[model samples]
Target: MNKNIILIGFMGTGKSSLGRRLARRLGYKFVDTDSAIEEITGKTVEQIFRKDGEIRFRSEEKLLVRKLSGQSGLVVATGGGMVLEQENVDLLKQNGVLICLRAEPEVILKRVKNKKRRPLLSRGDLLENIIKLTKERESAYEIADFSVDTSRLTFDEVLNQIRKFLQQEGYIK
Candidate 1:
C-alpha cells in the first residue's frame, strides 16, 4: 500500500471507521482529518462550528488535507463536506487514490440520527438536509477513483470491498 488512500463521503458513511480498519488491514497509518482538527484545535467539531464557524473549520480542514497529501502509506478519512472544495479534492487526488463511500440518504440519516457531534445535522429534518447535501455534493464525490456503497454493509464487509478494489487497481500487492 504505497499510495495514500483517501476516504470521502457524507457523514455516517463509515469513512472514519472503515478507513481505520482498511489501514490496519493494509499495514498503513490511519489519519482521520476530523480527529486531527479536533486534536489541533482542542475543540469538538460542533464546538468549532459554534464558535469559529464553518468557514474557519473548513480552512483548517483544507490545511490538514494538504499536509496529509505529502504522506505515503496512509489511509485518510475526510470529513463529510471536505470534498466540497475543489482544492482539497485536487490535493487528495494528487497524492493518492480517492475513494468515495456512498450511502443512501435514509441510511445516512438513520446512522447519524442521534449523533449530536455533527453540527449540520443538529436541526430538525435531518433526512431532508442529508438529501439536499447529497444532491449538491454528488458531482464532487463522483470525481473519486472509486465508489463504495455502504448502506447495507458491515464494517468488515466494507473493508473487504475496499481491499478488493485496491487489489484490482494494482495499488496493493
Candidate 2:
C-alpha cells in the first residue's frame, strides 16, 4: 500500500504548489482539497463561503477529508483550517505523513494580498488578518508530523527539506 503525503498550512504557504511538485517527484497523484471541494459542490470556494457560509463549507471539507483518507499514493494539499479538527488529522494520518508549510505574517500577506479568492482576508487588513489567523491556528497546525518555513527558502530548498523528512520517515527512498 502506498502511503500519502499531506500538506497542511495557512493560505499562501506553498501547500498547493509544493504538493504538485512533490507529487510529481514521488510519482503520486496530487489533490488540492479546496479545489476538490469546489468540484464536489459545483461552486468555487468563494461562492461556497459567500452562499453557504464557512460552517457549511467546513462540513463539505470534512466530508472530503473522509473520502481522501481512503485513498493512497496521493499528495494532498489541505484547506488551511482542516487540521483544526482532530478527526481530520487522525483520518489522514492513517495513511499519510502530514507536513505543515509555514511563513511569516508579512510574507503570507504579500503572497496572498492580491488574491481576491481568499475569503478570510477579503475584508480585513491583510497582514493583521494573517497574524491573527496564524495565532488562532498555531496549536492546531502543530499536529503536523513535519514543518518547514517557506519564507526564505527556494522551492528546491523547501522540497529538499520535505524530501529529507520523508526519507527519514521511510516514505521515500
Best by TM-score: 2
Q: Please, what is the TM-score per model?
A: 0.96, 0.98
**Residue 70: error of model 2 in Å?**
0.7
Model 2, 28-84: lDDT tens digits are: 999999999999999999999999899999899889989999999999999998998
| CA RMSD of each candidate after superposition | 1.1, 0.7
- Model 1: CA > 4 A from native: none
TM-score of 2: 0.98
Q: Model 1: per-residue lDDT, tens digit, 10-31?
A: 8899999888888888889999
Score residue 27 of candidate 2 by CA lDDT: 95
Collision pairs in model 1: none
Q: Cα miss at 21, model 1 (Å)?
A: 0.7
